[model samples]
Target: MRPDLCLENAGRRYGLRGPWVLRGVDLTVAPGRLVRVEGANGTGKSTLLRLLAGIDAPSEGRITGRPRTAYVPERFPPALPFTAVGYLTHLGTVHGLSRTAAARAAGEWLERLGAAAYADTPMARLSKGSSQKVAVAQALLAEPELLVLDEAWTGLDTDARAELERAVAERTAAGGSVVFVDHDPRRLAGLPDTTYAVRDGSLVPCDVAGPLPSGPHVTVEAQGPPDGRLPDDVRRTAASAEETGPGRYRLTVPAPHSDLLLRALLTSRPPWHVVRVAPRPDAPGSSR
Candidate 1:
């Protein structure tokens, strides 16, 4: 199979020589496959996307790919000005598109992303969701072989989100590739094949073969020895991971979203994993 992108032992540190945002990273994305990077704020998610897009050079390691890439960041740059249409038209012109052709491309992307009405508005003047839609449009305008979206869905509503998802799916179907970051995993549920967690200046695969790092502060202790493993849903949404007692585990989750976590626990379809949340904290020997 032909590999569309390859990074070997990649490391990046902004400035001449300082702290590194990404270190010892290795990844490969072939044609027709999607990989996601997931993490909390300030976890180098954007830095990683930049590295993938070749916007910046990696301090160490190597990247091999054709010049088929598009990058869409969370917020459009102030330099682009508030004129979203003009921004795209100018970008297209830089790529050697004539004014008329540039206007045509910009118009099509604006309509496709549902930001047609906001076409002439300056990007700085657009709302968060609208501005993000502009960024999406910018990335997809040229239809690069590889597209990188950084926080691409942060500002979109439900319908807008669905439209963007469909667009990406269709692109992949046509032999294009994409990589993007999403703050909310729920928004990304149907988007990526592999989700990566970024933390402590590192990027690692997440939501595969292990539990998520966040939990509702629930710990499990078997009366006897524990067996098998925890479910993927628990792992993906787990807040933190800590071993409490012997053969017992505790998962901390945001208190407000505790019920959603519990509901997921109860509704395991195959029924392989079962958690019992004790109704009262004071209750003896209760678990979920």
Candidate 2:
């Protein structure tokens, strides 16, 4: 049986006479897998993602298994007239949700990504980071079967970026496929099920079993009132927290998850103040 998405010797180029940007690519995207694409600038990464998201057609060869997909491009046009929430609602409907359902999902995603307060703000008025949040929310409003992220984390706050990481994890956990390209080499650390490098206009398999760190862990210290609380999502990671002083507390989280924890502390309704984020005492190179 064919995988959820397959490209057999697929290739693409611009107008008839344009030089080929991507060629002779064979890829199979299975269900519930995390695929990462890596390459330098102007090397066809965006072209490959666009083709996978069905935004562009391949000039040659065949692609099968068109799953319902959502794509977040590297750049988001923020001049649209719709309010952030309204825009997301519109996209949700386009993705097949009912009007009421779409609106609710929009609110939910906006809240999750820390953009709820700007829900009513016009897209043109939102700051770059806020606009990026809206762009991400729109793609996630309908729970697409395939999620393609092209540097989608750019311009997002630390917390929002971590929220996106969680969303990616959720999508794959629910039996969906995810493909992404991020500038950070440690973006997801050692999690992708497969990694492919775009080389010479073709796709090449990368070593998924590379010796990357398991999960760089960090310790954070923050200060807040006695009654302050952390975000609910922080519990997902094996994080530990405790009050160390009259108004100071400490949290130990996996490095990748630290952003979420810190965001929770700093963005809380009362807003805890972070003191420091350092590698755990026992972590590699920490003692030296």
Candidate 3:
């Protein structure tokens, strides 16, 4: 089983006397959870993610539980001598896959991200969007237990962006953990199990789920285990959950969060049975 990645009161800085980039950070990336880190430019969002991915060591405190990890940085270097597929294949082998298996997985991810046409193109010759696709593919080719992404969607087109989201959902549903940073508030919207913000060189919990929009909401009816217990993530994501009968629940959540809530219920150990799903016409705006 994969262990939770933990950062306990961690701090980092450049030089011995340099100012701290991040400090007093305590975070735990648990299995099957999605975490979001938010901050303006130069607020150490990337630094924090680097710590989580083991790319950098903390200047103080400690980080423990290093799971099999992969990371996609904000900028991907495109000047490598190898072709896109070759680069990904090389990375796959480094992650412990055999040469044949690595090449096969490389091809699959490239095709899924709609970049198969550029498979043999030199890394430096590919377009920015195509290069970004290669970068995303390499991180996912290994099926890592911990995935860290820093603005991994910046250069992708609409279809590629949607494909990455689906990949993230699949990872978490398969009992992997993911942490990401994106500029768009709606990137994952209501899907994150927990959201944190970097403020004044510290990590702080923040409510990313702002006020409800004037759009329609979703109502899900599900039945939990025989003990009538729901997963913590399912309860946290729902706006309101009421028990109408034993082991049965009616959950109301914003439309954007419905998929995440359902994933939590259905992916639980014993799994929750969904009875029905319908849109709540409480809001007077367009459907989501």
Candidate 4:
């Protein structure tokens, strides 16, 4: 069967005489899969995403099997003259929804992203994080067959970031395709079906250590008094743990149950002081 999207020897560059940002790249996105793209600065990651999202045309090669796609750029323009909900509603209509439906979805998304209070606020008046919520909401309003996110999580708060993760999972579960780029090595952790790294102007395959433990996960590192001990329950269900320093330890816990684990540690007779809670990184992957 044909893939949902395909890039055959795709290449892109700027001005007639400019150097190629990307060239001779080939890739495919099948239905229901999540793909992650990684690269260092100036490796054409954003350019590639723009090409896939149909925001920019490739200067050479060919792209085929274009699906209805939505993209969230790394930087969103929040100065548009419209209220938060109004802007999203307009974008939804542009994506083909009825006005009423668009308005409804706009409100729904804003609520989901914890931005409902700003629904009536003018876009220009929203804060960076609030604007990012609108950016994410606009892309998801249409339920496009292909979703492309370029550092879409940059300004989202913890809950909003987690909500976006759930949205990605929902899209793939409904048989759509998603591709994203984020600086966090653990962004979405071990969930992607395939990963590609942009290097030296070409796309190269990369290996992820493995799928994340069968549920949402987080790696929590903590430091406590020399005599404090983690609750036995925490150690029992934790995927792994290790002593990082004299009184520091890192523990991996299921995200849904993280609060319980955290509470256990903090409520212990001699509580363990939490240091950091971050998404767990997939095992080291080979990158060319």
* lDDT of candidates 1 onward, in order: 0.67, 0.83, 0.87, 0.84
lDDT per residue (tens digit) for residues 126-177 in model 2: 9999999998998998888899999999999989998898888667655688
Model 3 deviation from the true structure expressed as Cα RMSD, one decimal place: 4.1
- The predicted structure with the larger lDDT, 1 or 2, is 2
lDDT per residue as tens, model 1, 33-53: 567888888878888898888
RMSD to the true structure for each prediction, in A, is: 11.5, 9.4, 4.1, 10.8
Task: Flag clash pairs in model 3.
Answer: none
Best-fitting candidate, scored by TM-score: 3
Model 1, runs deviating above 4 Å: 1-3, 78-82, 96-98, 207-288
lDDT of 2 at 138: 89
Write the number of the candidate with greater lDDT, choosing between 2 and 3. Answer: 3
Q: Compared with the true structure, what per-residue lDDT tens digits does model 3 show for residues 116-221? A: 9999999999999999999999999989999999999999998899788877876776688999999998777666879999998999998655543444579899
Supply the global lDDT for candidate 2.
0.83
User: How well is each residue in 1-288 modelled by candidate 4, as lDDT tens digits?
Assistant: 235698999999899999999999999998878899999999999999999999999999889999889999999999999999999999999999999999999999999999999999999999999999999999999898999999999999999998887777667655688999999987776657789999999999898765344545678888877755655545533446677787688887657446656776777667788899997545322110
- Rank order (by lDDT, best first): 3, 4, 2, 1
Off by over 4 Å in 4: 1-3, 211-288
What is the lDDT for 117 in model 4? 100
Provide the lDDT at 76 for model 3.
Answer: 93
- Each candidate structure's count of clashing pairs: 23, 0, 0, 0
